[model samples]
Target: MTEQVSAASNAAVDTISRAGWGAELRATFALAWPLVIAQLAQNALHTTDVIMLGRLGPAYLAAGTLATTFLNAFLLGSIGVVGAVAPLVAQARGARDIKAVRRVVRQGCWAAIIISVVMIPLLLQIKPIYLALGQDPLATDMAEQFIQIAAWSMFPALGIIAFRSFLSAYDATRAILVITVLGVLINALIAYTLIFGHFGFPRLELRGAAIATLTTNFIMLGMMVAYVLRHRRLKRFNVLVRFWKPDWPRLREIFRIGLPIGLTVLAEVGLFTAAALLMGRLGTDEVAAHAVALQLASMAFMVPLGLGVAATVRVGIAFGRGDIDGVGNAGWTAFVLGLGFMAVSCTLFLTAGTFLVSLFLDMNEPTNANAIGLAITFLMVAGIFQLVDGAQVVAAHSLRGLSDTKVPMLVAIVGYWAVGLPISYVLGFVFNWRGVGIWLGLAAGLAAVAVVLVARFAMRERLGLMRSRA
Candidate 1:
């Protein structure tokens, strides 16, 4: 009788395992698709902005592009802090610690508020930096006009990111998608109106675009807050609890995990920002080509980037359950999927690079020829790095699942500064390979990160750090 019961129990466990796998697959897709579309829409906004400004002239295009890129570097770290809340909330959900989850959400929101206040001065200085880099005076002025007006939106933008992270953690992932779609439409309509002086709106040019984007972001924030408050499951947990007092220990813990991640991200942004500055020394055409390539790269990266984000939730949940095998499986699954997608992306870029470049370039003009050619060349180097780029991002999130941030930061510092930037400088200046040298340096840095992060994730899993759900 006991033997028969044991056999039945084993059968039940097998059934549960299969069911769990199915559920994870469903959840992964559900989480990934909306986020993926949202990312694409965000990229579309930049592309649309560029296209509209390009119609105005190359100088307008260059100015707007540079301003937005600088803003991303400055304000983006706040999103990294929001990221710290994801794993914490996921783990809290797994542990059924509703109080802890509520605390994390509120603290993350406050952290974003503080970051926005601190970032304002830095935002105002962007124009000076462009001038110091020797951009055309008119172009620099236009860029400054856009960036300064756009900086006002950082408060809501940063705060919304925290809210989004918390919502995703609580499995209210659909809210962000709905919000993003609405925001995208608003951006388009407002930009159209303001940029062209349509329907009684002021013809503010580049600054108009900035104002539209800012308004859309606030709208998105409002939509998300409303969703969370109305969410039944979230309401049951009282996830919206207002803290009469801040929780110091929990907030400190968040900063401890989040700050390093933010710095690591900032270091990478610094590398590219510095590269853009150095490219200015090369010439305006070089800067234009570099910006074009970077923007295209950012667009292509959205797919794998979304996949890595989904992997985080999967890994976080598995870790909370202490499922070592599950951690390995989830990490590898994301890695494989990301690599496959990047492989396709690399092929597409290699085959259609010049064609893609033409879409963003005013190729009808003889003056635009040099920039277009250089952009095509950059695509080759970018293609080489996509797989490595995908791998590193996936591995990084997998490691985050294990709650390992410090070592990842150390690795980023060495990979980006010790190796990438110096090699890029040598190649671009010393070897005179120009942009190719810079790209090769980027490839090398990403490869180092990919290898190190993968090993780290594996080591943590092997040590039984992040375990299975069942």
Candidate 2:
């Protein structure tokens, strides 16, 4: 039964891969919306933490913000590494190689586990790292406390990414959405109860938030694992049947494709993390404001991020089938969708900057005034870069569909570190523009990368990016 269903689904995807732009648009939208909502819900878990901690005061908010920034750098980097599963599985499915699909997923799981084991210890060293960077002593101490507990969540967190990548390639995103939305709701409630000592819970404050994050990731991972195993269509792959087996070549392949991806993600995320650290040097309010503004920008970014995921699947499938036209259609269609949504978001950020930032801080509290004001300013700048940020991510993911990551990784390093970071430091410190200056630098970096990536995709034929099609 599972084999029959899988065959039917693959046939449909094959048809879609050869279809026209209109058909491709519909397929991408079908695959993207649920994933978009899931991404938003996933981000909401952190947004909830930021909101809850905000009520505790700038000190707590600052600490939690710093801790999460540090942790997410590693978490997102690992996710990028494990995320190679989506395109790999998509390609295998396109080629009608179910056995290869299973191997890719199993190896992906191995990659996720290995990454978690390596990252947890480094995550635990947040205090020393922050102190070395000259962050506030109180905030650093509190951030370290949060990291001690939160670092362990990396296990379940990376597990969820691996499963999500597997499900995404199969176009089974509705399950991903349902599971993630439930996780968000549960996380918010747990965070509220524990952070404030409500419903007979202890007010663990920062610790409570950390626990909420850990608990939510575990639940989400379990739910994902159960879905993949119990769903008739998905279980046919038997992804974990030989759980103890090692496929060294497959593992190496994942790393080969995934390491640059991980570094690319780290470069972009690290750019923002570095910006957060730079803000910390200015003042607590500055870092706090940066967090709120960054969260809003990140939430809006989820739409394009989801579209990018869809592009990877669509393009990967097309690549596997040697449909160059299909690859172009998929990539361009996602680019259009991403740009359209970001234009809308850009307007909102520009028009409703103050109102959106207010959601994270208490307007009634005088102490929050500085942070709130700074957040509004930062958000406006974020609005300006929305289009470019959306462009770069989708373009990068589209290239991933073609297994064109190494160059994009190099592009990111150059655009971000060589171009963006220096501009941020000079403008923020040397020129004394402070937080706004740093954000402007972010805009520049995203814009630079976007231009290069979009051009790369445009020249795919000339660049021989399609030569690897199976």
Candidate 3:
């Protein structure tokens, strides 16, 4: 018995030691690189899908764009609801509350499942809405089929995200990297085989892409579940069993914190999706150009997105530890790093905008001349926004670290809807400025969000520090 107690005590100490870095630059990088790699892998799969679909036909390309928009607007928001798990789990780690940590994760997974079930039907209903919105019939039909198939994967994908959030909050980022890499690889292989009719499989076209993504999600979910089951740390919780024990109070707490963030995410996505609609009205080439520009911008955003995730973990842990200075320092570290990266991206795009745009589109075709022109203009606009985009995401994440979400939603509504969407519509249609005008509106909105979120974080940090002192 004494020997067993000694072993258990050693294990507890090890877990605590692994919970965080020492607030040093090197230590921060050591914690952050894995997250960056995971984000890169995820982005690579998205880029690959676009490249492959672009090769198929213009209809396929357009369908992919529309389908992706629906996925982000609907299913992605639901998953964001579970994103509340991260800071809470990280804080629990900081406070050494193992039971609370496990409970948060388990309830989060349950919430994700419920969310996925709700989202699947909403995605199915989007087809009629697309038709109602006057999307080109062929494009709308292809997008509907793709969304229907892809929406089914939300359950598994979100389950994977829930587990990933659990592991990452404990600073086990390597597991996330491993799982995401495997999923991306599987997606690539399956997408290639099915899309091209390889290995005696029938060519499934757009459906193949959807199936590949779906299969990859299932594989990721299984891998995460298996990891949790076999891992020593989670074995105590009997995660398979414990994950189902619904804690109503914790669920309410999670909803209180998460719903606003989810809505804020939805609101931002709604703005961009609405911009896509406005672009669609401009013409086919312009819409395609908009899609290409958005894709590249998304790729660029991954760096800041990963940094934001790291910032949330670091800030939450620091807050839990009552280290006000450490929280502010971590936020600064992530923000500076993200801004520096965006500066590099801006320079690269400015120098090679045409060349970069050409890579994703067929510039040699006369049909693409308008697209090429529009894409370059949009890329230029995106270059300006990337700076503010990075800053705002980091700022919003800093607020997440303080477990604040409500004010950000209000900021998103005003910044994106009240300001950005109206400006986009006017410049694109009324002023006839086209895609560039719409993009300028997006930049303005992002700048607004950046300023507001930064101020909000500063205020919250002061209050949190005061409370800690008290």
The CA lDDT at 295 in model 1 is 80
Quote the positional error of residue 330 for candidate 1 in Å. Answer: 1.7
**Tens digit of per-residue lDDT, candidate 2, span 342-416:** 999999999998889879888888888888999999999999999999989998999999888999999999999
Residue 438 of candidate 1: its Cα lDDT?
86
Model 1 agreement with the true structure over 347-402: per-residue lDDT tens digits: 98888998888888878988888988999999888998998899888878777766
Candidate 3 per-residue lDDT, tens place, 1-470, comes to 34433543343234233423244345556667898888888877777778788777666887888888888898667766888988888788778788788788888888888898788888988778888998888888888878878889888877877787787777778888998899888999999988778999999888888899889889989988898888887666565674567899888877888898889889889999999888777777777888888989988888888888888888888878877666666776777778889998888767789998888888787777877888898898899888889988887887787787888989989999998988888887789887888998999889888877766565553445326522
Candidate 3 residues lying further than 4 Å off, grouped into runs, are 1-22, 462-470
How high a TM-score does candidate 2 get?
Answer: 0.96
User: What TM-score number comes out for model 3?
Assistant: 0.92
- Compared with the true structure, the alpha-carbon lDDT of candidate 1 equals 0.77
Candidate 1 TM-score, C-alpha based = 0.91
Models 1 onward score TM values of 0.91, 0.96, 0.92
TM-score-superior candidate, 1 or 3: 3
